[model samples]
Target: MPEPIIEIKDLTKDYEGKRAVDHLNLNINKGEIFGLLGPNGAGKTTVILMLLGLSEPTGGSIKISGYDSTTEPLKVKKITGYLPDQVGFYENRTGLENLLYTARLNGISGKRAYESAEKLLDIVGLREAKYKKTGIYSKGMKQRLGLADVLIKEPEIIILDEPTIGIDPKGINEFLDLIRKLSKDKGITVLLSSHLLHQVQKICDRVGLFVDGRLLAEGNIDEMAEKLFNNKEIAIKAQVSNITQDLIDDLKKIEGIRKVSYSGDWLIIKSIENVTPAIAKSIIAKGGSLYQLSYEKYGLDEIYQYYFEGGVRHD
Candidate 1:
């Protein structure tokens, strides 16, 4: 496997007399989106702060691209871009002006700065609003612009915190699409910290479920499901035409098939493994028309709820 672009080992943090992060460990590969998922006050922001060198960790270490966040903070910041939940810009400055200013700060000057800023504006679908003052930009518009701001620095990694809190559904989709496009096109690693499970599930390649400053689980949805559920059973739903008792009996006879039943217009099959193909073959052989077939894939929301609500021990 390729070396992880970002690494955190036994990372812990404390505020006042309470611990905010506890023995957290994670690794993020290059060109992949890693979601840090949890609710409010889950220590997500604190971890981000430590990673960015904005706050010191009470214990443990963080390394970004091989630069120690604590000792080589400047080097870490040089290759990392951060977007806070609430992005701020010069309200009186036009969108283009804001981007140009950021580019200048990053040492890209003269015509190069303008070209880079304009390119990012177009890439983010904000070219028309480039000349509009940011004071009039909506929340979604600001979030997009914030993305453009982060890109101005040409950082290898971008950290976003609560990026879609108040945007409408359509806006959220568009913003997320832009993020995915950037990661795929530029090979940038993204650390998206958010409380929204569904939105994170839509873009993240892998997720770390965080609760009360601890990482309860980590992996893609399917991998996590196996770890948490122990692969005990799988549920499959199928819609077939001309269903009969004989067809149901045949399905149950298939190896690994445990139980078969009818729910509404769908046949629900509980099995020890995914037997979708076998189920389909049986349906076709029995002269039944298959309309829809889907297997139970655990979603992030279900996994989060199951683990957090005492379905499993954190240990």
Candidate 2:
């Protein structure tokens, strides 16, 4: 098997007395979209900076494409592209000029830079706005321009911090589609950092959750879903009469039932197995009318909560 494209061992970063990243460890395979998920101030930015060689790790090491970030920063940077959460562009420069300038900085120049600029603008949906001054462009357009700049070098790895932050609904969708295409067509490995769980859920092959400088959990969504919920949920609708607290309590006593709550006239319950039959039988046998009962499908939101509430800590 090919070696992993990105690897980190016992990574750490500190600012004065505070620890920004605490002994972090991560491995990203080639051509995979890896999500670094966490809430605000969870060391996401610190990790990205360390990975890109913008800040030196207080301890540990990082390797991109088999080149150590500490010992081989130049070679590592040559194959890496980064898009920051807040993009700052020259207001006076046109979209085409920005792309050409970036390409030139990467050793692409003259006709080659022009052609590359045009191609990247088209790829990022900025072809029509190529000549427009960035000052007058909308937030979404500026983001697209930033992406064009990042791709001008055709780097093997793309590190995006809050790639969809501040983008409108349509722009977010477009950017996501573009990322999928880049990964599939160009085979570029992506490290996406975002606070939004749903966006990570949509694009990540695997995700690592972090909190307060600690990695809480890391895995695929399906495995997380099963581990958190264990494939169990309960649904109960109003039977012949209105649902009561006593009836809810009685249903809770059934074997395998984990939690029971009321949703309007329906009783929501979660169980490990076929709980409907037992619940229905119990309700009818106890002289209470049976309205309806069925299995409930666990949602991602519910499962996500399980991780934060019950996740293992790595400190």
TM-score of each: 0.80, 0.85
TM-score of the candidate numbered 1? 0.80
For candidate 2, give the lDDT of residue 152: 90
lDDT of every model, 2 decimals: 0.90, 0.80
**Residue 242 of model 1, lDDT score:** 78
RMSD (Cα, Å) of model 2: 3.4
The 10-residue segment of model 1 with minimum total lDDT is: 305-314
Best by TM-score: 2
Q: Which stretches of candidate 1 lie over 4 Å from their true place?
A: 231-297, 310-312
Candidate 1 residue 9 Cα shift, in angstroms, is 0.9
- Candidate with maximal lDDT: 1
* Candidate 2, superposed: residue stretches over 4 Å from native: 226-244, 262-268, 280-300, 309-315
Q: How many pairs of residues collide in each model? A: 0, 2
